[model samples]
Target: MKRHTAREKAFQLLFQMDLNEFDPNEELHEHHGEEEIDSFLETLVQGVVQQQTTIDENISYHLENWSIRRIASVEKTILRIATYEILYMEDIPTNVSINEAVELASKYGDEKSGKFVNGVLSKIIA
Candidate 1:
């Protein structure tokens, strides 16, 4: 089985929350056919949700003239995923995290969202 992209999975969970007020933790079982999620991605998703305040802080610190609350839902989700990967998963290269984040933003976020994710992550990595 192909593993679902973390952002893609997160997108579904977040969308469900937005529309139905369901808990994200409980909603994850509704997996669509996709790549098998590795342990790393599972950790990333959980870490992001568990340490959202720290992730939001990292984003706020790196994002000039932007607040975490003001970011779009898609962009925010990508940021949280990538930030968690960056901070918690040492095995995944920094470049891969940044690239995945950019891809996620492009697919789910607005036109400007990819650039924003890239910029903030670059700062965090540097």
Candidate 2:
């Protein structure tokens, strides 16, 4: 799968994991069924899972006058994914991570989500 597509699927899986509290491996198998799992997708989901506390801490630190808890789950999840990429994924450029995250927020989150994500990620990379 293309990185874009893998990222999208990873977002969906992570979103579900956030909402449902399911294990990533089980959820991923259920998600793909007979299809082979995408390596990038697996890497993203697992990386986010392993590093979530650090990612959330980073995101929370970047927020201005906002508690991480107050953020909507969609925005929070998007932020987590982007933050993970920025901090952990050396191969992907920070700009690419931010742009892709903004796109995901624009597509899946509320009206303000894209800007909110961009703002927070900009702070993260700054």
Candidate 3:
């Protein structure tokens, strides 16, 4: 059987986070084992979880009055993952990270989520 890629796993893990609203590490354990996730994705997930406050702070900084919580859970998750990738995962290009996050937001968020994600990430990139 085909397994979920790191990115796919990250999406689901992030989704679980929205529902659970707990520590990402615990949420990760409930949803995926070490073998179920890849090294890169695991690193990304852990990094995001660890630096969430800072990452979110940066996002919130760029959001003006829009808090991260006010944003849709899917959009928040995509942003968290993408922000982690762009800020920490130096191996990945900034555009690739933002584009992937925007794509995920488009699929999992509301109709305008793509634009929202793009706008926020573009601000970070700028």
Candidate 4:
């Protein structure tokens, strides 16, 4: 799978994990259905899960007027995944992470979600 696809899958897994409290590994198995998990996908999910507290804190810090709890689940999940990549994955470019996150938000979240995500991530990046 392309890294983009891996990131999207990772986002989906994180979203499911956030909403349903499912284990990321279990969700990966259920989603993949015997296919091997892509290494990047595994890394993304594991990274987000392991560093969620710090990631959330970063997100909470950048959010303007909106609390982390107030962010939509889909938006928050995308933010978490992107934040993890931006802060932890040195190999990934900051613009790539931010752009992918905005794409995810545009695809999975409300109309304003992409803009909202961009705003928050830009703040974090700056």
TM-score quality measure for candidate 4: 0.96
Residue 17, model 3, lDDT: 72
Best of the two (1, 2) by lDDT: 2
Query: Which segments of candidate 1 are over 4 A away from where they belong?
Result: 1-4, 14-21, 32-38
For all predicted structures, in order, the TM-scores are 0.80, 0.96, 0.84, 0.96
What pairs collide in candidate 1?
2-34, 2-35, 2-36, 3-35, 3-36, 4-35
lDDT of 2 by residue, 10-115 (tens): 9888888888998999999998899999998999999999999999999999999999999988888889888988898899999999999999999999888999
Q: Give each model's whole-structure lDDT.
A: 0.73, 0.92, 0.79, 0.92
Candidate 4 lDDT, 1-126, residue by residue in tens: 999999998987888788888788788888889888899999999999999999999999988788999988999999999999999999999999999999999999889999999999999999
Error of 4 at 55 (Å): 0.3
Candidate 3 lDDT over 76-109, as tens digits, reads: 8788888888888788899988878877777778
Stronger candidate by TM-score (2 vs 3): 2
State the displacement of the C-alpha of residue 46, model 4, in Å, after optimal TM-score superposition: 0.8
* Model 1's TM-score against the true structure: 0.80
TM-score of the candidate numbered 2?
0.96
Residues 1-126, candidate 1, lDDT per residue (tens digit)? 223455566655654553466654445544533544545445655677678788888888998888888887778777878888789888878898898889888887788889989999999999
Cα lDDT over the full model 1: 0.73
